[model samples]
Target: MAKELLINGEVITVNANDEIVEAVAIENGKITAVGTTKEILQLQDEETRVTDLAERTLMPGIIESHIHTTMYGANVLAVSCKDPEIRTLAALLQKLKQHASTIPAGQWVRAWGFNETSIEEGRFPTREELDLVTDQHPVMVIRACGHLSAVNSEGLAIGGITRNTQNPEGGEIGRRADGEPDGRLIETAHMELYQLAAHTRDEMREAHRVASAHFAEKGITSIHDATGYGLQNIEALREDAMSGVIAQRVYAMVGALNKPEEVVRHYMQLDICTGEGDEHFKYGPVKMFLDGSSSGPTVWTTAPYTSDSGNYGIHYLAQEELDALFIPAHEKGWQVTAHAQGDAAIDQLLNTIEKALQLHPREDARHRIEHAGLVREDQLQRMKALGVIPTPNPTFFSEYGDGYVTNYGDRAQRMYPLASYYRNGIPATITADCPVADFNPMRGIHSAMTRKAPSGQVIGEDEQIRLLQAIRGYTLHAANASFSEKETGSIEVGKFADLVILDRSILSAEVDEILGIKTDRTIIGGETVYLRSKEPVNV
Candidate 1:
């Protein structure tokens, strides 16, 4: 057995009892003991490595529930367009222009993280504006929501898009007053644009490495890679993880969104479904997308947005189409999940899942609704009764809360109802959505309590949860989402030693101070994968 002991920490166990212990003992990368320093000291032998915590805080390594490993990696290496970075349309265009100037004439100039709400002009950049950046090279600037994008003339031509090019089944192409293509691609169209401007294998590998290290530095030990482009990308990611390019435990999702229909069909022939593989990498749910983004005002809403009258937003698939995809996956015993942001989309999801369950029910199969951004009182109750899990992104409160208030008015309070999830007996998991918003687990925890925008406006005061509940959402609850709770979620005697040592005590800190709390060290399986301090961690 390995020898390691940590003591004198505010150890928040996030267990059934929610205990705060003083120390923990580790053996063979699993928790061996937990209690006061003296109790843990008794378990330590002469060869054991015991380290003083010096009154720091220790908790489960933050589990980022839903993140796009490869996508976030590529976005990190792209131009900056996210709010508080490139705020004005002119400034964004200028940044793209500067980036274009450095690249070769025929190369693609890509940018990500655009927020129309946060920018000075409060609008999407036109294709013409992007052309001004550079017409010689194809340019695609994707919105932060990842639901829409605007590409230059060259890009449209490269994709064979024209005024007459019809909108795909689940996507749209922007057009000007005269019916000329305007360069904007929405939903599935953006997916096509991504395909046209796909990153190189070398580029993706390099970016994946950067993203892995970044997640480690942020104290994240586990993540769900929700959107791998196709089987090829999935294979590549698995290889990366197996080779230690990705250190964190990965719950890699399979076909539905980026995966071609044929690829999914072929996969069904395999003996495996979900929950396949080992501790390092595992197959997750059959994931799919059902609607546009709430912040993009393209969410499939039952009520028209307050900001856009007579427009109820977009639903990517019909009930029949969703059933064809989901019912098969559910029947096959794979956990099913979809990106349903608005009430209308969630409604569609509930209907289909209910039908699938009626056909063949698995009591323990926790089908999930990702980004249930907006849900009514009735929907929440239905979710609890049907045993559907709602995985919401609390960090969106910091990035899109003001826009939600502006677009939905009082109805915005229904978005990401964390407190209501608990009251209704649902263990709603929380996510940061990474490239869509801030990825820090601390920011997600803070958003759960405040429900505030960067402007300090609390959009949903009634939905705010307590600090401990928020902590649970990111730790044990997150692990439960992937069926890995028994192995890694808490500080139990047999759980993996996936723990984060923080510079300050989040349990004792004021609500606002939580965001500033940095991770001093991140340990996974008794190994220090990341350490902020340079000093020796000796016995």
Candidate 2:
């Protein structure tokens, strides 16, 4: 392949020294040189392709450390009940009703991104309310947190759930005063119904295409798919990756939900443990959810919620159960990344991981605590000692910071302590768990640098970090989380040419203006996959 030269731009090489260069040269999909434009041009030959960046800010393509690619792709087709779209209960019903009309009667109608706090009703829409939208169609709307779902009466019937049906051990079914199902399903129950409302393989393929295009347009060249449901989801992802439908490099975490042992066994039989695939697609870790979402008020906490004095949230797994699953996987060399939001859940996760390490110690295992939303000083120290990375969504602070204050009071100050992570020398990765929040990394960067919530309140000003640190959290630190640092994180020599060009310099922009920065072009492996129409340039 001909060498490609990107010049006349600010190349923010997020390397070890955080150097800034004016140009970079790529050969065979890897960076061959980085320096001043004149220096880089010296290496160019007649066969080289030269592209002027118009002084745009060039950097490594943003890496979303935690996301659900397939699900996010599918959600693009689902009815969006997100904020500013449906902020009232009546609006939600109207939106659902409108969506139901677009689909055939008796078919399932799925929607996502519903936040109770944003609605005037200040609660999840009930079955009766959803039934008003469409009794003929089976309707289900998932909360922004992905841990809760509210379904219509038809949806409940389709799932074979009834008043007589008992709640699953790790889940709950909301009930009405008359002992009938009220349409709200939490945690495992929500997941089970979600499985029942499955999409066809063809549908998933289209979803993958849509999602890949969306990510590429947003300048995301890589993502860590936080959850892969089963072999089927994994197969679809692989097929998409191999077929080039998914342009972003994917590191999937095998979800160990429902039948944990069975899932582990299936992966083991296939001999696909961590670090099993190429850069385009790879298996990274075994993921399990130990608690629900803090925003949903279902996260397992030692203290009761401030709003509800008696409710301490839910714990999805027992210690023995966690041990039974994690130990075997750890023994087989699968790094674990468990979702633990509340402090209590964090404690449980830490204990389980400590035991697994003691039984069969693996140095630099890099077991991760996904969304360590709330942690005490002690837990931070323990995380540092265990070499466990805490991957938290800073976007949550900007998008749902008010909700955190409402749910946890002053305790919300401790949520996603980026500054503390830096102080403790804990390598952390900032992510936007898409569908839960917008996938734009700039929003996360802004939130971390300012700690300013959507309500214009600074939840924890002291916890804010520098803009450079936040950027690293999304680039170098994020790649390290997936064990891909050696291959593609920064704009380093010999690294994959996964790079993005921004319209503005985020480094010098005002904190508030950071979110306004736009992607002018996104290139992966020296291939220009997405470029602004007006700034058309050859790949």
Candidate 3:
């Protein structure tokens, strides 16, 4: 194969194999040379492809440790209320009433990212308010936290939920002060009806394309997508990969919530793990959520919530139940990540994981603790001792900081502890719990470094990580968490040529201006997937 040289740039080589170099060379789809311009030019020939760097920074492609890609893509193009004007009960109803003319009556009209804290009047949207929008159409507005949703009476009836209905094992049906079904659905296990909303395969595929384009434009080379909807999503991803439309490499963690274990077993039957297929796509861990979001009333907490004292959210997996299912799954050598937000839930998970590790003792197991949000000082040490990775959604700072404040008060301030993870030697990877938060790495990086919430509050100033650390949280640590570090995380010899060329160097940029750094180009395996300007270069 012919050589390709990238010259004249500040290269941040995140690989130990190569020092920071002024130029790099790629032959086929792997790094051939990484050094000074003169050294890279030594490998050049008439057939070589040379790219002028324009003095911008060249680095390993960005990786999102945790993102729900297809879901986020569909949600991006979904018909719902995200704009502030339509966030409230009255405004949402008005907006739905406006759009209802097109849809047939009695169809489910679902919208996502509705925050109760965003409502100026300051209260959860009631069933009555949703009814005003459309009794004919069952309108369900999911909370921004993904822990709750408010649905109209028609939707409640459709789901077979009623005032007399018991709360599901790991979920709840929010009730009014007068003891009525208040139209709010809480926890993953609680919202079975909403899970049924992703029935349209075509819509999901379209959304996946949009979502992928969004990441490519921002220079994301890889993602650890957690929302495993089903075989349909896997098929969609496969189709995109085969066609070369999906440029970003993906490490998928199949979820087993309402999804059958047989489905997970089916994927396991594929006998795939780290670096399963060609450079672009692979399957990694199996994901399970033990609780819900901290900003919503579903995260099982140690004490009663400071806001709502009577309510301590429930746990999804009972001890005996987990022992039966989770233990066996872990013993079978499946890398697992559990969504345990509240400290108590995390403690339960820690205990469960410890037992499994003792029984299994697979050194390279690399199991993960998803969300792993709230932790006591003692728990931090335990996490480090266990060698568990925390895939934190620091994007929560920018997306739901205010909601967290309202939900947990002082406790919320310490949520998403980046510095704590660093201090305890726990390798942490940051992410956007997308569809709930925007799946933008810049947003995640900004939130981690600044700890500045969308409401402009510095929620956890002490917990704020440095810009460099924040970058690694998305890149190196993210790759490690997914067990893809060997092949993809860093820019090194024999590594796949996954690279991002930025218009500005993020490492040297002013702290506040880092988010402004845009991607001029994105390359995967020596192929330019996204190029902003193709005008002839001066060099």
Candidate 4:
């Protein structure tokens, strides 16, 4: 159970001539060579397990290209409305009345990353402020753009919602200027208040093992799970990645964002398709939802939104309900997607994936676009002639790049272009839709090379990129968006050693100190699940 090598490192081998190389080599778990450190230590023996890397910065591990992993592992065991720790709305109702006085009385506290523009009363916390965080409990909260939520009036009398309910056809329910039922809830009204306080199967298997050990301590080995709803989040991520309790590596896309036979006619009546499983869970692409959340105002944009006034947001399907689920899952071979972020929901998702590739002409149908979030240079030349895969989420440009230039004005310089997806040869990927941003792939590679925006504002300086194309947009265009780039993105040979060592020298940090560079080990196939402290070596 040994045989790795690693050596005095810098590796960054995001391959195809983007090489850096110093040393590499792993055995049975793949990557068996990459030169120097004296030509790979002359093929070490005696069950070699070297790993020197005193020069730190070995790459390729970090492929989140659109997440939601069981709703960020049940919002990492819920009840913390994020952002500088609940900034204000009276500190998110005093941390929801101290977590609803430690759960009891009619259960369900729920919370999750709330963001009314990182609070200070920018809004959203009333339902009489989550029933002043308790009225025999039933709170809710949500909204760090999980398509809004609010609840608590004992959650509209436990989801019998009221004020003559009605809205649900692409959702809304906010109402209150004498009509009542204002406990927010947008987009299919957050799936029946998230299936009425779900979260059980042993608390979602310890919230996907604390969201896969907090995404392998931010080195995130792999993940696609865009939360398309049913098949119960791909059967609890293929039974928590087949019992090793999910320590990364998963694709899991399935569908159902409000019925269509709960995940496309029940997975086109099984027999598996799209990329299928094994290698710690696979089977992705089939998901839906055609707009909303590019720093919320509810996306679907084709103009109007200089911060509201006649807002052209909210589209939510009806291209015949997204060609009744992405054209027969793109002609029954699978690999299709949605959750677009407005270019009028990426033009109704490129006119239903160009009419399902002109009535089925499939062939590497990468069919993604999850969050192109406002792209439009002729929709990036028709998503580079329909090969379409642009996962895009560069830390949503450092957490909502100044409310994306005050709500899509000047179209926030074609948001999420990532240097126009590497100047047109688009394989572009990069994500972190975590509990809504902060999955930390070095702050999505320094917000794709400083498209900066924590007030020192630089939101989309011509869509900045480069720094190994923002580290191959989270490692090899996020493993070509789950076709798994010949199995696990870079430092390539036979792939999957699934690297990432880093402590410094991401080619000389300082793009706002690359998310304060850290992570000291997070392998995967070649084990070492996550270390966090290991440096000081010489030989």
Candidate 2 clashes between residue pairs 3 or more apart in a chain or in different chains: none
Mark the regions of model 2 whose C-alpha exceeds 4 Å error after superposition. 256-261
lDDT of 3 by residue, 11-125 (tens): 8787644356788888788887788988887887778778888678888888887777776776565455678677556787777777666678876776777776677766667
* Local distance difference test scores for all models: 0.85, 0.86, 0.75, 0.80
lDDT of 1 by residue, 1-539 (tens): 57788999899899999999999998888898899999999987778898888778989988888888888898878796863568788889888888888978998898888877778897788888888998779999888888889999899999899998999977889999999989899888888777768777887788789899999988999888876477766776777888888889888777634435545666667898888888888888877777888788788889888987888888767899889988998899888888899899999999988999999978888888988988999999889888888889879979888888889888888689999998877988889887888899889999999999878898888899998898888888889889999998788888999999998888889989998999899988888889998988665
lDDT value, candidate 4, whole model: 0.80
Candidate 1 worst ten-residue window by lDDT: 255-264
Clashes (N, CA, C under 3 Å) per candidate = 0, 0, 0, 1
Candidate 4 structure quality by residue, lDDT tens digits, 61-156: 888878877777777666777746678888778877887788778878887778787787688877887787778888888887787788878887
Candidate 2: deviation at residue 184, Å? Answer: 1.4
For each candidate, give its TM-score against the true structure.
Answer: 0.96, 0.96, 0.91, 0.35
Off by over 4 Å in 3: 1-3, 17-19, 102-107, 132-136, 176-180, 188-190, 242-245, 256-278
TM-score of 2: 0.96
